[model samples]
Target: MPDTAYNLTVGDFNCTVFSDGCLIDPDETFGLNCILIEAEGRKILIDNGFGENSTGTAGLLLDNMKTVGRKPEDIDTIIFDHGHIDHVCGTFKKDGSPVFPNARYIITREEWDYIKSPPGDNETQNGFYRHARQYLLPLHDRFDVVASDCEILSGITLVPAHGHTPGNVMVDLSSQGERLLCIGDIIHSPREFADPACLAAFDVTPAGAIKTRAKILADAARDGTFVFATHFTFPGLGYIRQINGVFSWAPI
Candidate 1:
């Protein structure tokens, strides 16, 4: 039992990163550093952990949630940074009921479309496409399809960071002059920050993924914003900085 929940303050807002637990597939398959982030007191979850079949990697999310005094019922919003299985499967109970019953789920329209009819050539990695429908179909009534650049809350905006997935997006939070970007699987391992061109095998379009990584790193560096990577070890919160032409991640 590793403590997967962590809290940080950005001006008046409190952000907590909670784990749904971890997945330990080959580093080449799902990327070496995929984790989870939960923002504290906001009643929101960025990405849920993997499901039971993911081995011991599954179910720690509930534990981490409890550590932060957050129960499944307490979540007001469940934001899917992307529709990958490891990130979305934890949304359901063993009986198929939504784990976070009261929260409204938000996902990009592009992501929704991709999940609905993923290309056949990419079936293996995109298999989560089908699972997304299975797990989320029940919540269609509460699912809010958003655009690439939509604001989910007063201080939180969704920034389209396509390439890894057509609708892969990052959540940007601005509160009282402070900023943080919750980047979901953009740069899985911190080492990838040093070479943005290095992408995980799961990347739908390797080249495009690299480009998106570069763009995100540049923006975060320029704005001096904090970054919360969903899969960067436990408590995956850090700041991105650039030296010369290389990017560096400093965990906080």
Candidate 2:
């Protein structure tokens, strides 16, 4: 298994990228990059990768955390980028217990409602629905559901980027005027930067996904905001640049 953990500073916040290794599908390999942000004496986990329930080289986020001197219990807040299995499964243990027992959770109200709704027709998506229910439903009372773009903390904001999922969001972090957008599954490949219309098969609403991607890429390019992509290669940190209005990924 690939054990990867990288640490960097985001203005006043200490940010760490921990990998749950890679999720290998038939067509592509996705890096399960989860972020840990330490701000205001809070250990906030952006997403929980696949945990004990998944089979494969993935599910290493918890193990990787040890390298940075962090334990599951150390997490005070867990913000789910979405309800996807890869993003929420690590919240629970094989015995149906929460991995981060002491942490409170946050997710968009739309996403929470969708997760509890009836399963969809797509078999693959239904499977994801089941996993989401198993891992997240049990913690219903612990969740703080937000209805719109709002700041959950002093420097972190959950901006509605809904597309990939009903209430999927991108985390906007600002400290001392430096900004980083944790665009969860917004653009899987760097190639998408130049062609924002490109769609990911997992997107529930392809058109919305495309629109959100285009807007984010353009805005990031214009504002010179750094980005942390969830499915990009390990330690997915980069800046978006535009040439002739075509955005491109410039990895740092």
Q: Estimated TM-score per prediction? A: 0.88, 0.94
Query: Could you give me the TM-score of model 1 versus the true structure?
Result: 0.88
> lDDT per residue, candidate 1, 1-252, as tens digits?
335666677666666666666556555323212222334456666767665435665567777667657677877788888888878877887667777778888899998887777346766665756668676776788889999899877788899999988899998887788887888878887668766555456687778888888888898888888888777766677788888977887877
Minimal lDDT window, size 10, model 1? 28-37
| Model 2 Cα lDDT, one tens digit per residue, 140-238 | 898998864879899899999998889999999999978889998888877676655554667888789998888888888898889999988888899
Give candidate 2 regions above 4 Å deviation: 1-3, 194-199
lDDT of 2 at 24: 84
Best by TM-score: 2
For model 1, what is the C-alpha lDDT against the true structure?
0.73
lDDT for position 133 in model 1 = 69
